[model samples]
Target: MPKLTIVAFDGTKFELDVASGSTVMENAVKNSVPGVEAECGGACACATCHVYIDDSWSEKVGAPDVMEEDMLDFAYEQKPTSRLSCQVKMTDDLDGLVVHVPERQA
Candidate 1:
């Protein structure tokens, strides 16, 4: 399992043990972490699972796909580092990963 550090816009942080092959959105949603709505489940249909990849771990997570890239444009507070958490699958290289949630999602 990989450990994920999720931080809210207000500075709240949650450390979750995520299973390999599961999406980051799954871990956040299952643990009731605030700011990750995951409204469309893990299907990538919604941008509620938006997150900002920590600069240090950005290279490990890589860039988002075309679909994910397009969807991010719809997220609140879109940024150069914005990504949909549902699209980020957990992996060994992502151990101790940190992501920041945005202020809003609709």
Candidate 2:
């Protein structure tokens, strides 16, 4: 399992133990981590699961693929690091992954 550190817009922080191979959105919704709506249930059809990957971990997380890039266009407060959580699969290398939840989703 990998640990995910999420920071909410209001500054709340949550550390969740995520199972490998799961998507970040899945764990967020399952754990009730506020701000991740996951409106499409990890289908990548919505930007409700939008998040900003921490600067320190950005390279490791890598850039989003074409589909994810197109989907992020609908996310609120989109940034260079913005990513759809549903497209971020958990793995051992991402044990300390940190993401910031925006004040609102699209």
Candidate 3:
């Protein structure tokens, strides 16, 4: 299993131990981490799962796909590092990954 550290914009953080091969959105929603609505249930159709990868972990996560990239344009407070959590699959190498949720999702 790998652990993920999710931080809210207000500085709140929650660390979750998730199984490998699960999506970040799945872990966040399962753990009830704040700000990860996952409105489309990891379908990549909605950008409610938008989050910012921490600078230290950004390179590890890499970029979003074309569909995810297009949906992010509809997210609130979008940034260059913005990514849809549902698009991020957890891997062994992602242990201790850190992501920040924005204040608003819609």
Candidate 2 vs candidate 3: the lDDT winner is 2
Compose the digit string of candidate 1's lDDT tens values, residues 33-59. 888999899888989999999999888
In terms of TM-score, how similar is model 3 to the real structure?
0.95
User: Candidate 2's error at 87, in angstroms?
Assistant: 0.4
The residue-by-residue lDDT of candidate 3 on 1-106, one tens digit each, is 9999999878988888889999889988988888899999999998899999988988889988899889999999998889999989999999999999999896
lDDT of each: 0.90, 0.94, 0.91
lDDT of 1 at 69: 89
Better of 1 and 2 by TM-score: 2
lDDT of 1 at 36: 91
Ten contiguous residues minimizing lDDT sum, candidate 1: 72-81
lDDT of 3 at 73: 93
Candidate 2 local accuracy as lDDT? 0.94
Off by over 4 Å in 2: none
On the 0 to 100 scale, the lDDT of residue 15 in model 3 is 85
lDDT of 3 at 63: 88
Count clashes in each candidate, considering only residues at least 3 apart in sequence or on different chains: 0, 0, 0
- RMSD to truth, every model: 0.9, 0.7, 0.9
lDDT of 2 by residue, 80-101 (tens): 9999999999999999999999
